[model samples]
Target chain A: MNPVVLCTVARMMAPVLLLFSLVLTVRGHDSPGGGFVGGLLATAAFTLLLVAQPEELVRRRPRVDPTRLAITGLLVALGSGLPALFLGRPFLTGLWAQVPLPGGGALKLGTPQLFDAGVYLLVLGTAMAFILGLLHGEEEEAREREG
Target chain B: MTPPLLLTLPLLVCLGSAALAHLCPRRAWPRRGVALAAMLALTAVGLLLLVEVRRQGVLAVQLGEWAAPFGITLVADLLSALLVLIAGVMGLTVVLYSAATLAPELEAGAYYALVLVLVGGVCGGFLTGDLFNLFVWFEVMLGASFVLLALEAKQEQFEATLKYMTLSLVGSAVLLTAVGMLYGVAGTLNMADLATRLPGLERPGLVSTVAVLFLVAFSLKAGAFPLFFWLPASYHTPPVAVTTLFSALLTKVGVYALVRTFTLLFTQDVGLTHTVLLVMGGLTMVTGVLGAVAQYDVRRLLSFHIISQIGYLLAGLGLLTQEALAALIAFLVHYIFAKSALFLVSGATARASGTYDLQQMGNLYRSHPLLAALFFVPALSLAGVPPFSGFFAKLALIRAALRAEHWLIAGTAAGVGLLTLFSMMKIWREAFWKGHPQDPAAKQEAPSSVNVGWGVLGPCAALALVMGVLGLGARPLLELADAAAGQLLEPTGYIQAVLRRPP
Candidate 1:
């Protein structure tokens, strides 16, 4: 099952996949792709890693809990809109800020971008949760069968 | 205060508490404290919205500074605000009751978070002024309810949820399609906007078809006669607290949507549509009571009664007079209070006696007189006995029907009132009047202590007192209801309020 070239290609492709997803996420509001597609791409990166070493992905202690990630993502989504309320605008109103950059240009950031980031985290967490849950479920079934 | 914030505040409070509760330790009492504060805040905001709506006539605000008919609007007319008020009251009482009796079970199941989310969804559904937004709120409500209903995934819940979730999804799908077709025809999903544009459409037949579509979808949720298969089949399987919350709020939301649409958008063909509602109301009444008569489970019996009460509401709406609308509001108040009280009583009784079967319950009249008294008031009130809120509510409905010369509907209303009495008496005799059904030795050796704790009995007594006042002091409520009815009879104020146009 372990093909050296395939594993090496997967390792190389993971970061590229993640970088492309984040780019898609940042550009999603004005263009076609956004947080939803970015989430899938991030999941794809993880799936590639799991494919390279299924045992390692399943057996290793997770550095992050997908559930906590999802919860945090939801909190961020909910909280991003609260600043608008404080500014005497309606709930979920998009509030923008002009950010001066290092060189000469300025960047525009707003609640919409914050919301997209939250959605990105939610999708990533949910996909990870599903994969891990299935792995654990399968492991439990195997143990039960052996017993 | 902005009208949109009325909707958003409740959601924010409830959802924030839910998030915090989820992140906290399972058994943390601080989460409970936060939940209690959240419930109190919800009640306060709901009451504020109600008062504001009553005083201001109708208040509507568009989210994100978008103008009306373009963005989703949150409208607080008298009807929605009133429903929200009762929901807040019910939520507060339920949370308090759960804290007293269900701290361990509820904490383990994250019941507070689920209940909060459900209430937020209900309030949101009641407040949304856009059709598709109503559907979204319905999803929020449905999603939370699905989890709460099957929190433990008990065997019966698994079976019941399979049925409940399937039918509810079908209801949602049909509603979405109806929203699509409405948008296709009128290019508007705002309720105020639709009321303005729909009447001018050339194809009356197409509008009536959509009317029927909405009627079918909402009736399925409201548990009207033919489409009510899911209510009795699944409602009684959940834990009593969850069942109580669902029983008091779920179908009523359906009725709210139906009343809103039928009164506003579908008023073009009154003869065909109101008559359809009238006949459905009568059939729903007879079948529901008959179903209740055939059931031994107390919760299922109450579940069927929910349908019967809905029948009364439909009949009142079919009449579509100011008095009839007033009667409808009055009936809504009596029903919400009395029904929740009855369910809470049954829950407390079940907790004590450890059964839901009428045959297995007895001696309550002898053993626990205060609890028995609490049960009696609401039970009689439910039967429309005089000196209770249900009596005045039913009287108003009958009087309005007779005034409108809807002689047949009036007769059916009276007949349903009598049948309602029969079922109430059935519970009374089986649960309270008869001798104890437990073992003789256990009864003989029983300790003499009446454990009618305030947490158990307080809410029931308070609600029953409110029902009593509603009957005895029906003046203020009648005036408030008449004002609400006035708002409905002429939707100009409501529409103009939402659209920001002077009528």
Candidate 2:
């Protein structure tokens, strides 16, 4: 019945769900999952946040404006493409660069995977932003009439 | 990298702009800019693609280099490039008009984001070479469209959108099922590969069933005749800019895919498919014009005309000649500009007078001479009046139909053009000249606040001007359309261009 505890629990799961979404996106090229499904999963995490938080508090705060989150994801995606332009390739050209991870292993980061991450961010951000914006507007309008 | 990157730019611009719009201090400015930038970027890419296709002939990008059957491919030929260009131009005009009028009322970034995704999906549909990928693009575009349509979600809009959504989902499901069955039969999702695999398949009934499913799915989306009831109900409910985008672009995506797949893969079964198309085309034109006659709303009337005009394009596909195809392409280009301009004109009028109901719009000719002309000329052009792009477009289609001895199609085309003029005049009489009587509910009450900013009117007037210019410069476009049609007839150039492997 304590909303703060519920909100904290939801917030704690956000990171875990976000990490899972990343995993889905990274292995997407080789597996059934891709950016779209991953994005939806991430959006679910945010939806949970809304559910756990009190509606009144959530309404006042303007939770992670979907529009802004979508833009940030797009920027990351666009940023990944900048490396291609530097290499004298066209915009959004996918380039794979292998980075040496700790313990004598390598981590591979590339334009395509980054693009997927961007897509994940975009879908999640847009979906949640739209859902909340709509919910907030209706709630505010109702509150005004009641007052 | 080049092909895929160019294709992805529109999507990026669309998604990126929406994201950025939220950060803008003046939300209206960013929303407008996002739409404007996305439109300009798409048009520029289209031009670049046209030049590249001309120089190199069909350009293909194997997304992730996983090869054709395994990975997705974006293939651009003269027709696909031309369609993308048309989408870009229409998008630019609608977005600008939206910025001027609707953006202020909209919840900033979400509206722009949905629009961007819609644009991205259209480009994907135009460029995709794989059957499965085409289905994915279709879903992407339709999903975004549902959000846009239901954005307002008034009682009427909710009703219309629910019907639209249910029907569209059914179409998508049928398309997915067909794709699944095709994959089972051919062992590949690549369209060209499917074509190669199809000739040897022994199951005629299965192929026929699948082909019919494709027709039903595309025709439903295309708003062709029987499946078109949803278009009139829903298109007019949204703000003018949204209506213009959907009316001009979305249905055309269905028509484009239908023509592309049938031309390339299902050519062997044209006897059944073409006959179906021809019958639907005739019914679509007659019924569409009839619907237009019955409607009082400017946007709904234009929506009806969209179905009639689409009928002409379908007629061309049924004929399947080089000339017919050329004429269809030319008509489509003209329709995109003209139809969008007409809707924008309606939006401008609504903003000026605070009503979409034609019965209420009064004496616009006196108060706003420029706006009246802006709306009038396109209405005339849409009716296929002489010296306009619509006239030339109709002339080409008529000539092609006659040459092929498709007498019914030729007669129906001309008849529909006349009916189109009738509906245009009805709007002219009711909205511009006589105007609707003051509403008792709102008459005594001060008029609803209307901000007729330059941001809105300027874009609409500019688009109307472009329609006139496109009408005037029909010769060059006609030649280009002919060339594009010729290329589609022999798709060897497209296949060869994409398959330019290391050897």
Candidate 3:
């Protein structure tokens, strides 16, 4: 079902795609990209790897269950809103801070960015769960047929 | 507590419990404990909110510290607070019931988490101040409900869920379209802002079109006529506990949205918009009762009754008088407790008789007198009999209709009450009064002798008792409903509170 060339390309591109997704997620607060898009990109990367090597990926399950990961991400997103309440602001009021970078530039950080990170994780986990669930179903059917 | 914190606490408790339950898949006690504690916390929050809203008039908070008309707002007027309180109580009771009756496999599959999410969504829907936020909450509720409907599903359940899912998605799309069009017209999504802006818009006709769209979407959700085919089809498919939760909260949320929007935002043309609701409500009643009359299955029959009762609610809304709205709120409170008790009783009845079919079942009055008593209180109440909340609820609605001089709807309301009584009597005769068809002596061992545990019967008894209390002490609740209706009729205070204007 697979071509050698396709497998090799997927293996090589997956890591690069993941790194690019992180960049997109972090830069989302100021510009066009955000958590949703970045999460989809990361899912695409994982999807490529799974499609190229379904057996290996399925056999060696990820350390964190996708469902739990998604739940954790949701908790993180909800938690991000709590800090403002502590500060006597509204539930989701964004608070910002500036960090002095080693390169002498100030890095702007905010709760919204943290929120986007949570969204990133949630979307990634949910999508992966959906894909992996389908793969497992197909695998079970195939095994049943063979047996 | 601050308004934002108070408003968001139920949602936080629910989501937090959902996560906690999801993380501990193997530990049954921890999951149950968390779910129980979370619902108790939700109930406490709901009580606090009700008291606060009663004292403070309307409580509004702008999330993200944004000014009104821009940021998402959470508002809890009396109506919202009351509905939240009902949802919290319903969640707690259903959790207790599930602990006894739910299958082990389903419980392990994160059923509690799903229920918590669904309750949270209902609370959010009740409390949200923005139109788009209402839509978001609807989606959240739908998402949880879809999984609940299909979790450990049978073939019939899968089919029913498909129908339910398709219809609900269409409703959501229609709702989103209406919201978008309204925003494009009014330049705001806040309910109060929309209320103010919609009337001032030059094109009253365009506004009415959007209003009708909102009506259709919410009508579908409320299980109103011509759009309620999904209810009886899918509702009877889920397990009893799930069915009870859905019966108690889901369509009522739809009714809440209808009352909220029509009274607040679409009053510019009550003659046009509400009249449509009036006609729809009447048809919904007749059709729903007739559907019940033809059914022999216990759950399906009760499902039809849900639609019929919804008709009374819509008719009350259609009347649009202060008295009618008050009656509607009172009716809603009565209906939730009564209907949930009925569903729980049906589950227990099925357990005792080994069948949901009335044709095969009988002698429940002889076999289980307590179950019969549990059944009678709600059944009589539902039939608008005296000494129960449903009677006062119906009486108030009929009086409101007569006062408004809506003679036709008034007649329909009375006639429907009679039909409701007929069906309740039919159930009583078939399930309890008559002897079992196959076992004339009614001594044969029934299948599935697993006793309906206290966990199952206790909530039913508690809910039935609540109906009794609400009926006997209808004075206080009537006053509360009257005040809530006053708020709905004159939304100026609501608007001022949300917009931070001096009133």
Best by TM-score: 3
- TM, every model: 0.94, 0.85, 0.95
Candidate scoring better on lDDT of 1 and 3? 3
Each prediction's DockQ against the real complex: 0.55, 0.27, 0.68
Error of 2 at A95 (Å): 3.5
Instruction: Name the better of 1 and 2 by lDDT.
Output: 1
- Backbone clash pairs for candidate 2 read A66-A129, A71-B19, B100-B456, B359-B436, B360-B436, B361-B435, B362-B435
Structural similarity of chain A in candidate 2, as TM-score: 0.71
What digit string (tens of lDDT, one per residue) describes model 3 on residues B292-339? 999999999999999999999999999999999999999999999999
Cα shift from native, residue B162, model 1 (Å): 1.2
lDDT by residue for model 2 (A24-117), tens: 9889977878788899988888788778877776657744556667778778877776676555444555788899988998987778888888
* Model 3 misplacement above 4 A: A99-107, A138-147, B443-450, B501-503
**Per-residue alpha-carbon lDDT of candidate 1 for residues B254-341, written as tens digits (9 for 90 to 100):** 9999989998899999999999998998889888988898888899999999888889998888899999999999998889889889
Error of 3 at B71 (Å): 1.7
Chain A only: TM-score of every candidate?
A: 0.85, 0.71, 0.87
Scored by TM against the true chain B, the candidates give: 0.96, 0.93, 0.98
Alpha carbon deviation, residue B442, candidate 1 (Å): 8.9
TM-score of 2: 0.85
Residue B166 CA displacement from its true place in model 2, Å: 1.7
Give the C-alpha miss distance for residue B479 in model 2, angstroms.
0.7
